[model samples]
Every structure is written in C-alpha cells, then in structure tokens.
Target: MNETTTIFGIRAVIEAIQNQKTIDKIYIQKGLSGHLFMELQQHLSGGEYNMSYVPVEKLNRLVKGNHQGVVAKISPVAFADLEEVVTASLEKDTKPLFLLLDQIDDVRNFGAIIRTAECCGVDGIVIQKKGGAPVTADTVKTSAGAIFKIPLIKVDHIKDAIYYMQASGIKVFAATEKTEDLLYSKDLNQPLALVMGNEGKGISPSVLKIVDEKAKLPILGTISSLNVSVACGAFLYEVVRQRL
Candidate 1:
C-alpha cells in the first residue's frame, strides 16, 4: 500500500475514526473480544472499513509495533464516483467530453494520457476496474497531481460503459489506425466519449462493436501507429477545435 495508518490500541482506532480517515480495511487479532472490542466492532460495523480477525502471525508481519489487536489500511486517494461526475457535467449544461481507456496498461502512458486529457479540458476519464493500469504512485506523480483534479472512474467493462454513455445520449468514438474512416469526417462537437486502446491489442473487439464511429488519425508517417496518448491528444484536440 502507498499509504498506511497504524493504531495499536482500541482508543487509537477510535481516534482514527474520529479524524475521518477512509480506512480500506481493518485487522483485529484472533480470539479478541471485550468492551474495547465491542466498541471497535460497533465503530467498524457502521463505517466503511472492511473488518476481519487474523492471527498474531499476520499482525507481526504487518508491523513490529505493539499493536493492541488493530491495524487499519488507508487508501491514498479518494475515488471518483461516476454518477456524481456524470450528473455534475450534465447539470453544468456542457458537452461531456469523457475519455475511456481500453486496457492501456503502462503507468507512464496512463499518466501522459491523463496529462493530455486534462490539458484538453476533458470532463472525466474512465478505465476498466481490472485490465487497465491503476492509478499507482507512478501514475500520480507522472500526472503531476492532475489525477486529483480530474474525475477517474473504473468500470467493469468498456462496452457496458459505452452502452450507458450512448443511452445517456453520448456518442463514443474509437480512435484507432485500424479504421480507414478519417476523424475529420465526423462531427465531434456532440456529447462525446473517445476510446483509446492498449499499447499492444488496441481496443477490444467487444468495445469496438459498440462504438458509434471508428475514427482514425490521418497518418502519413512511415510508422504504423501513434502512441496511445498522442492519438488521444489528436482526438481530443479535434473535439476542442470543433466545439470552439
């Protein structure tokens, strides 16, 4: 974990709770129960902490401190709720410019993409909960804290996210060299989502099927493709250009 919080005794745990730190989970030593335990249990049950009981061995592995049977894992950053982000954008009466990254696993690429997206005034970024590169320490630092400013949502599947966007009247445009359809042919001024794929596989076939348009960057270079972030910039700039 990038960040951690340790509360040795029950009182410390209560203090942490009182301080309003978001706990990822909590570990209580095995065969533990008492008034203090009850207090801990009550506090945890009503709160967001994932609670569990573990042996002393696990607690020892966690730290060398004299933990009085409690350890809490702290999340580094708060997550962006998709509904709040989407609804707020709609409420603003502005076009929703969402960027959906399909399996872009490199941390550097992820950060660079975020940097570009934020620079282009993108409303939000969406990545799959599993396959995509998570916002790690590297991603955070690479983005230069822009990750904190822009909304990032992790979804189960890109296709499902796409479907929801379409239902909400957002058009999804897949930017890839595989498509002969030039980006300039389409109207990007509408509420739009740009899908940028992985470094190796590009967007999955499942995701591509649902895209409203497969728009390609006009490539006259000898190289076959542009980096995911570079192509993302191209697609995003086109949107900005059309909107302006």
Candidate 2:
C-alpha cells in the first residue's frame, strides 16, 4: 500500500470520514480510548465500514508517524455512482458491458481484471463495499494504471448490481464451473453484466440462483480451474469476439 493513500492520526481519519472520502478500511488500536476516539466513534456510529481493532504495534508497522491509534486506507480512485454509470451507458448507442465481482479477494486478480475490462471496452466494474480486495498501491501498479480509465463502482451487495442490471434490460451471466453452458455458446452481443466470483468459494449459491444465465470456460488441461484473472480475460475477449 502507498503511504500517500493512507492517513493516520485520529483527527485526520475522523475528518476523512466526515468529508465522505471513500475509505477502504480503518484500523483502530485495540482498547484505545480518548476524547478524540470518542469523537471519531460519533462519526462512525451508523455507517457500514470495514474496521479492525489491532494492536498499537500493528499500527506502528502500518505507518511511521504519530497515528494516535487510527490508520485509514483511502481509495485512490473515486467510486462512480452505479445508477449514474448505468443510466449514462444506457444512453449511449453501443452495447454496454459491465463486470460485477463477487468478493474477489486478491488485489492482483482484481487489478488484472480491471485492466482486461478496460481493454475489452467494458462500461463499468462493480464490486461490493466490504468483502472484496481494497484498491491499494499494488492494485494500481498491477493494473498498469487502467484503474483510472474505468468507472469503478462499489455497492452494498453484488446482488444489488445484478438486480439493477436486469431491471435496466441487461442480461447477467455468472461465470462458474457449476454450469454446463459454455461461454462460446452465449450470445454476448447485447447489454449485459458478467459476474466473476471469489477464488475459493466460486459464486454464491444465492447469486447463482438469480443470474439470467450461467456459463463456463472449458478446462481441457489437467487443472480443473483457472486463475480468476485469467478466466476473466477469456470471458471478456469472447464478448469482444462475438460482438465483432
């Protein structure tokens, strides 16, 4: 992670939260208590945040300067409003393709997927607020700066984005090995969102139940599965091929 994107000190973190900055996570020293911390608590009361209570030693390792028992990771890219991005894409004349990630945990995988999506002309990428990888400096590096080129959206749940996509006349397809349908057989030349799941769990059963269709890439080799990023590139390029 880059120090530039991280802010320490209780007051500074509190200000960032108050300013409504897109914070990926917050680390508070365990058993920390002070007037400033109390003030920070007031701001954090009802909000949904990825918070961790760690030791002061961990906080020390996270930042060099005086942290005052709090350190926050701020997202380098501003999250786009999902409704606005979807609405704007709908107005465009070309078919809109969106990528929805279901709790993708690895930063490198997330970054590679973003790079591939941008290359394939995807309109936007949606991820959940809490479960997915936080956009760190490593992610920005691995993406080769493609993170800045696309509209990255964060939603409360992946299902919310799927529902929105379906309501907006976009078909949603979940990429999972559980399906017999092949990716090449699907007609990708239309407005649609593709759901890529986590590394281990695959797509959530509930999510699989709601998608308009489920498709998978063939695994001819001895390995039964491909890396999520590699699999994502294959799926995206197939869309590119079918559209052309």
Candidate 3:
C-alpha cells in the first residue's frame, strides 16, 4: 500500500471522517479503548465504513510511524452522486445504463468491470460502500485508467440503489445463474441498471427480489460458472449490441 493511501493516527483518521474523505476501511488495535477511540466511534456511527480490530503487530506492519492504534485506507477516487448522474443522463435525452455491483470484493475484478462498463457507455457504476472492493492503486492499474474515466457511486446498500433506480424510471436487472431468463430475451435499449453479484455468493436475495428482471448468459461448457468480470463484459456488450 502507498503511504499516501492511508491515514494514520486516531486524530488524523477522525479528522478524515469528519471531512467526508472517502474511507475504504479502518483498522484499530485490538483491546483499544479510550476517550479518543470513543470519539472516533461516534463519528463513524453515521456512515457505512468497514472497521476491523487487529493486533498491534498488524498496525506496525502497515505503517512505520505511530498509528495511535488506528489506520484508515482512503479511496483512490471520489464517489459520484446517483441522482445527479441519472438527472444528467435524462436531461441529455439519453437512456441511462447503470451497473450495480453487489459485494464485488476483488480489486482486479472490480477494475475490469469498470473498464468494460466504461467502454459500453454506462452512465455510472453503483456499489455498496462497505462490501464492495476499495479503489486502490492495484484497481487503477488493472482498470487501465478506466477507473478515472467512469463515474462511480457508493451507496449504503445495494438494495437501496435498486429502489432508487426503479423510482427514477430505470429498469433493474439481476444477472445470476439462478434465473432461467436469457439475457438476449430482455430489451436493453431502455433506461436500465444491471446488477452483478459477488464472485462466490451471486446477487443477494434482497436485491434479486426487487429487480425488474433476472437473466443469465447461457452456459454450454462443463464449467459451472463464469468469472464475474467476464460475465459482466458479456452482459454489457449485449446491451451495446441491442442499442446499436
């Protein structure tokens, strides 16, 4: 990890949170408790931030300086607002195409998805603030700079994003092997948001329940499933083909 990528010390971390810095996660020394820790906890109670308690040795390994029992990994890119993105797309008389990722924790997979989405002219990518992968140097490198080119919105929950999209007149689709609906059968030329799930678990049940449609790519090979990034690329390009 880059030194600039993390915020060390309790006061620094607390200040970063208060300043609305995009924090990926925070690491605190185990058994740590004090007035400062309590203050930090109070500030963190407002947003969806991942916090982990680890040994002091782990903190030491992350930084050479005094961490004050706390370290915060910062997001490489700032998040975009979903409403703004949608409104802008509508104002321009363009049918919006958004990608919602649920619990996509692999940095490289997330990066590759972003690259594909950008190429497909996706208006924005929606991700849960806690479960999704952090935008790090590795993600940037894997994206081939597409991370910087695309708009990303981090929501408190994936279901909330689905609800918001539906309210904004965007049809939401869940891509999963659990569904028998074929991807090509759906009309993708309308305002739409496609939900891609985690590598292992697929889309969450709550998210799948609320989506307007559920579709899957047909599997002809003996393999049980496709990699999340490859599946995402196939889905996105299908949308591109339909639009053209």
Instruction: Compose the digit string of candidate 3's lDDT tens values, residues 1-244.
Output: 3312887999999889888888888989999999998998899888778778999999999999999999989988888998898888777766899999999989999889989998999999999877677887878888888888889998889898889889989999999988888999999999999999999999999888899999999999999899999999999999999988
- How far is 112's C-alpha from truth in model 1 (Å)? 1.0
Q: Judging by TM-score against the true structure, name the best candidate.
A: 2
TM-score (C-alpha, index-matched) for candidate 1: 0.71
Say which prediction, candidate 2 or candidate 3, comes out ahead on TM-score. Answer: 2
The candidate that wins on lDDT is 2
Give candidate 2's root-mean-square deviation (CA, Å).
1.8
Model 3 ranges off by over 4 Å = 1-4
Per-candidate TM-scores read 0.71, 0.94, 0.94
Model 1 is weakest, by summed lDDT over 10 consecutive residues, at 1-10
Per the 3 Å backbone cut-off, how many clashing residue pairs does candidate 2 have?
Answer: 0
Error of 2 at 72 (Å): 0.3
lDDT by residue for model 1 over 72-190, one digit each (tens)? 65545666777677777777666999999998989888988888889888889988755667555677778777777788876667887788888888889998776779999999988
Ranking by TM-score: 2, 3, 1
Error of 2 at 210 (Å): 0.8
